[model samples]
Target: MILTTCAACAAPLAHDAPRCVRCHTRYCNKTCQHDHWRRGHKQMCKKIHRGGNAEQYHADKKYKEAVAVAVEACADDTNGEEDFSTLRAAINYMGSLIQLQRSEEAKALYRKTLPVARRVLGESHEMTLGMRTNYAMAFCADPAATLDDLREALTILEETARTARRVFGGAHPSTRNIEGGLRQARARFALRELLGQAVPGELAPPEPQLAAAATPFAAASAIAGHLGMDPQEANAAIEELSELKARDPEAFAELMQAALSGEGADAGDQDP
Candidate 1:
């Protein structure tokens, strides 16, 4: 026989009571019944507590539980294969759970997630990188993730930015923005590490409006440096690029092809 329990408290409930009147939990007694509804369990409680196809509700619940279980299972293994999609879902849902102030459960989720992220992404992929960024936020969410944890998270972000810059390009949006952030996080971590305190504005805040924001000219300058060219040469190449845009616009539709193809200032370079 299946034991029915209160959705809210997980206590055993009476077979007859479908709706918890007090806490809106499925319950066995008038007290559980009255307490469920009487304690201001009107809106969200009612929705979660009642009126669904039993089999389907159970199935959906089971599916989410399975996902949670898989997340834990993966997290538990010291050396597990990368499961980026599952890690992404776990990060998102765990964030939501944290926002709801479900701290214990959220921490458990994070524990499982962090190891999987480290193992699978090898501390580099954007997903793992993103979670590193999120850890400080999780601390901000709960205020209990020790100062050390936040510092470690920021360290990971710095590494992430470096990897992005090297693997992608200085001009690529992710590389540019995240590298900038890594610089900031490094500065902050340095201060806190040395001085044992957070300094204001030490961490470079992410660009608020990434889409319309102008590309980082400094990155272009850096690329020029990396390629052993002066800023003027870079500008000239960019000017040549503008001319290319006018003549063969479609060739450089989504990106500045000169940068991507590394044909900077090469007169021989053609769109086709």
Candidate 2:
């Protein structure tokens, strides 16, 4: 069976009438829909039609028409030079569409909306970055986000956090929040490092490879023996004690415990 009345205005509609590209509502004619959108229907377009009550009818009908028009205008590449307000309106409408479970339509809207957001808000503006963040999150929700994309986003976010810290302060909420996220991403990258540990030149051999790797006591004794100087130099004395600790596990444990216990000791009483 074919219906003939417009779903929106209830005016007579053709059976094969072209429908709203967004909400899929049939219209009597393009003129009726256009006037409804421009005059009164624009505000309610993001809503789904559920009832015929006077208020519901008006709100749903107008909003649907308005959204359809906005979506079309936004998607029209020919109108790529539209003003910021129009672009923002389209972005907002698309968000509403997404909430209505119109994911495909919302994605199309986002694609067009992002460029305008970048242009009108400027590359570094808060609004622009927010839009970019929203777009990234949307992509992340997809089952297809590759590890490479996440890595790239991690790098971008790290730079963004650094810029925020330089512009604001390290403690600023934006900088701190982004810094926290960057820290997590860094921890994830550390796993990659662990995997490549077996590769040559990756992990340096433990401290013996370091020139002064020996206990302070051994280093001091070696230096004293070579230089003919008293091992009374503070560094030399520390080296000598370090060697003592290395030769006796019990002595090293005692020293470590004492150091930790004195963590809050007064500066004047602190041991070098």
Candidate that scores best on lDDT: 1
**lDDT for each residue of candidate 2 in 1-272, tens digit (9 for 90 to 100):** 24467755788877667654433455778876675555434323333232443345556656776776666566564445456656656655665564444545666766776777776766666545544444443333332333454465567666667677777788777666666656544433332222132122432225432222122222322333233334233334344445655698575445433332333323322211
TM per candidate: 0.33, 0.32
Write one digit per residue (lDDT tens) for candidate 1, span 110-147. Answer: 67677878876776676666665555445434423334
The parts of candidate 2 lying over 4 Å away from their true place are: 1-82, 90-111, 168-272
**Which runs of model 1 end up more than 4 angstroms from their true locations?**
1-84, 97-107, 118-122, 176-272
Which prediction has the highest TM-score against the true structure? 1
lDDT of 2 at 224: 36
Provide the lowest-lDDT 10-residue window in model 1. 209-218
lDDT for position 166 in model 1: 77
